[model samples]
Target: MHSLFILSVMLSTAVAAPFGLVAKRPLDDRDWTRSKRDGCPAYLTEGQYEFPHYMTQVSKSEPNLAFGPQYNGIFTPNDVSTVFSFDIPESRANDTCTLQFIFPRQEQLKTSSYAYEGTGTFVFTGYNPGNCPGPQTTYNNQPGNGPFPQFPPIHMEPGYAYTIDVGPCSVGAGTCVAGMTSTNDTYFSYFQDKDSCPIGIYTSYS
Candidate 1:
């Protein structure tokens, strides 16, 4: 009886262990560039150059201040945006995953001069070989709304690619800006419950 009880406990522990996947900039080769908005300098283009949207990779391990110059110290309020994409491995097929754009704590933001009061939105879309739809999930972050906002989880299928569009917009009539800290790192993370999968795991942006 004792052996059976021990076995049951072990199984319960395994079931409760959480596991998931993660993809970050620089490390995963998910670089950011400028988006098209025009009116900007020619050699200053990166992602697209139509709307002042820029994308550049940043690392927690090193300094990346030289990437986006014009919009430095501040992510343009509503006028600029960034994009990132990653692939879902076949091992996690048909798994329900919670997607989150991780950022530094509120206290960290408060201490940085680069921080701004605004609402940041993340749009996530899942795509397969020949099937692609509108955004599957959208997460919005507002000033004084805590460090992490509640974003709806998503179900991810194996062999599919995902794209996350992150943009910041002004809050109401006031200009909204996102602050950055020298010691803090920002990236997207995906979580999967252990009960629904074979293993539990946690991943970091670095």
Candidate 2:
């Protein structure tokens, strides 16, 4: 009877899917039905996306732990990364888009020379399941933790804007959902806004 009761309790508390309530569904990567085009879509307008609080941060070691504005990462020094999402509507599927990132000039630590100036980027196809970044999101607006991010290809600059054609990553459109990974570089990294400037990854169509 004791063993049976323990199993029953475990079954009742499940994660996502059939665990308890909310259903976690993977991104649908169905083959696109629309014809591929060489030129940009006639209807494609410029897309500039920015998240003020951004979504939260994530830690590779502790996947489930939450860290944001107030708190840092999972360690004393705290290893954290921010994930930016570019959620294009299903209406704008099959559209070629540009993935660009901008890190303002003033955000970095004042120095004669530094390595964090040359940052990196990565792309993914998912969205954050937790709440958006905010005062309530985490401690010290540090950066929250969720899943993990990987990227060794994209190279970025500080105060200068560079873009690349990464789409339609949403091959079939299918309510294209993509993300940009911001991994740590130096002790003081870029990406965080300056005094009044906003630093982030942008999605634009031209």
- The local distance difference test score of each candidate is 0.20, 0.31
- Best-fitting candidate, scored by lDDT: 2
Q: For model 1, give the 10-residue run with minimal summed lDDT.
A: 1-10
Q: Candidate 2: where are CA atoms >4 Å away?
A: 1-54, 68-78, 107-150, 172-176, 180-184, 188-198
Q: Estimate each model's TM-score.
A: 0.24, 0.44
lDDT of 2: 0.31
lDDT of 2 by residue, 1-206 (tens): 00000001111111222212111121111221112332111111324342322344545556556654421111111344444433455555545544444333443222222234223332222232232334343234322322322222333444444342343433313322333243334233333332223334445543
Q: Write the per-residue lDDT of candidate 1 for residues 11-46, one digit (tens) a residue.
A: 111112212223322211122212233211121123
Each prediction's total of clashing residue pairs, residues at least 3 apart in sequence or on different chains, is 27, 17
What candidate 1 gets wrong by more than 4 Å, as runs, is: 1-74, 106-114, 119-206
